[model samples]
Target: MKPIEITDIDVSYGAKKILEAITFHADAGEILGIVGPNGSGKTTLLKAMTRIVARDNGEIRLDDRDLDSLGHRELARRVAVVPQDISIGFDYSVRDVVMMGRHPYIGRFASETARDVEICDHAMHLANVAALAGASVHDISGGERQRVLIARALAQEPTILLLDEATSNLDVSHQVEILNIIRDLAGEITVVSVFHDLNLAAYYCDRLLLLKDRKVYAAGAPGAVLTRENIREIFGMEMLVKPHPLTGKPYVLPVYMHQSSAGANRRVHVVCGGGTGSDILHLLHAAGFTVTCGVLNVLDTDYGTAMHLGLPCVAEPPFHGITPESLSGLRKCLESADAVIVTAMPIGKGNLDNLRVLLDYPAKPVLFYARDHSTRMEDCTGGEAGAVLANLEARGALRVEGAEELLARLSRDGSDRD
Candidate 1:
């Protein structure tokens, strides 16, 4: 059953309606993620629920009781809110700040009891900030401080916990740590968190609320809320949604704009594997380098990346064997190109022919970016291409150190030819 509910809630700042009758609920033991682009009123919703922003209309209820009906102590005992930002106007010990969470239980004109102290200590330990307990709040890192605030909320032992972009400023590791911690607290507390990281929300949240045009555009399980069309419409950008490799959750990958080539005339064949080939194709298109590739098997990350960019890619079906016909197509692409690039993908049985095709085409200068070492070559393929690349280096095939160097040389040389 839902532990907290927002019913047609509206809030206004002077003449502006910050929230437009927003409504949603948090089920008991469920992690609900509210995700939206910046200025989408995510923080405003959190504030409205806490009664920090007086709702101009509608009602908020907690476990069947209207939030407006609850007294300060009653609300404090039931709901714990970790605001988007916490400013320590005056320096205070971490322990003292966490102890503030025990305010609802304290008797008037009385000090903290042993039980309160124990709860504070446990909260500090749970947040992994026990060592910082005695330190001043101003002296800690932003992530640490955020954890401290969360710990304080946990100490409150509320039935519902609200977090506003709690992991926004933290690094990847810390974000994961905090997310895992929130996920672990699932059965004990109904967590409603505002998340800017769509990927993280997809992985962790049981349900997601995608906000757009001042209302809930979609709300359901992460998979439902994070579809390709929903993301494009709401976020105002094109993206590829795939399943996470590890967790099987929906993964959001934003598509970027590619610059088209200045001239419509020349086709440049790119020999790319892995993700290294994507940038080259993009730059080539911007500079009007007619780009085509062969031997990149379907399901290869590089192939998928290329297809995502709308490049004319000749992809072979995935298999243990690379067909001769595919090799012929690759050779044809090479022959048609005014220039070629051999991105550092390891030579293997499936793609050794791709490297051999480059070696065979000595007429065109092949810019080999040695980004990946020979050891990265997963396909043994008799070690012939590795030797061939070394031989080509000795024989004057250009060997560049990085992608940038390759692009700089290409832009200059291609400009001169035009």
Candidate 2:
């Protein structure tokens, strides 16, 4: 059975409707993230689960038990919440605040036992707040206070943990630390968190429930749910969704670029690899050019960049040499292109055809793009690649340095958009 399930949930704030027709389930021992824009009812959903806000209509079950069927103390023993930056009006020590998590288990007339103290101490250590146990919560930094809240939640030892932007106050380093701690506990404790940062959600959450306008927009794995179209549709903004370097998970990169029609009708095919054409692809695509790239290996960074920009690319399999089919595809891209730009990527036998093929397009305007003076094409093919490059340059292959100059020259060439 799912650890938590909410079906057809509706919530309202007074007469104002907040959430509608929300349905999702969190698997046991998994981290499920609830993410969306402001006023999207993320916080309200959490409150509904905790009974802090009444659900207008829905069924919420915790481990097969109806949420309403559980008593207050029993519910506390089953669930815990780590909220954003809560204020401690009274001067309670970190230990005291964390110890409060154990109150659900203690008898009404009884005091804390040795085992309760042990649980609190272990929780503090797990949260990296052991050293601050004796410090007043008010005296600690905002980030430290947040960690104490995590320790408190851990002390509860609840089967399900809910977080409302719990790490919003922590710096990147501390945020990672806390997330790592939480992720380590995934197989033991089921977590449902409200995440503001899409990248973090992509990296951490096993499954995501995306809300748009207070309704369930998408629900699935991070890779499937955080598509470029979904982000554009939900947030009304365009973002590049690609694999992160460290984790290989989908990472969201906002396109902080303005669109122009300067190259509106222009098509430019880029010949690049080894990350040499990443920015060039982005630059050309942003400048409103219909860009195509290739002869790139599927595993190449430039290939990744081209895919991110939604450019039609000619790609070969990893470690595979240029195939006849891909070369034919490359020829098609060049034949219809107004211009071709080749970056200063390495030249080896596997990709030597990428440069040699340029000789066939003598009439096409060609630019040998160098991102900087220090990085030029290295001929690894015993001078054959260099000779081909020399031939292209001889046939008027202009060498353009830097993004601005390349853009300027392409703008001039691509003015005939028709």
Report the number of the highest-TM-score candidate: 2
Instruction: Kindly list the per-residue Cα lDDT of model 2 for residues 222-258, writing each as its tens digit.
Output: 9999999999999899898878988999999998777
lDDT of 1: 0.81
| lDDT per residue (tens digit) for residues 33-62 in model 1 | 999988788888888888888988988999
lDDT of 2 at 382: 96
TM-score for predicted model 2 compared with the true structure: 0.86
* Top candidate (lDDT): 2
Residue 269, model 1: Cα distance from true site in angstroms? 2.0
RMSD, one per candidate, in order: 3.9, 3.2
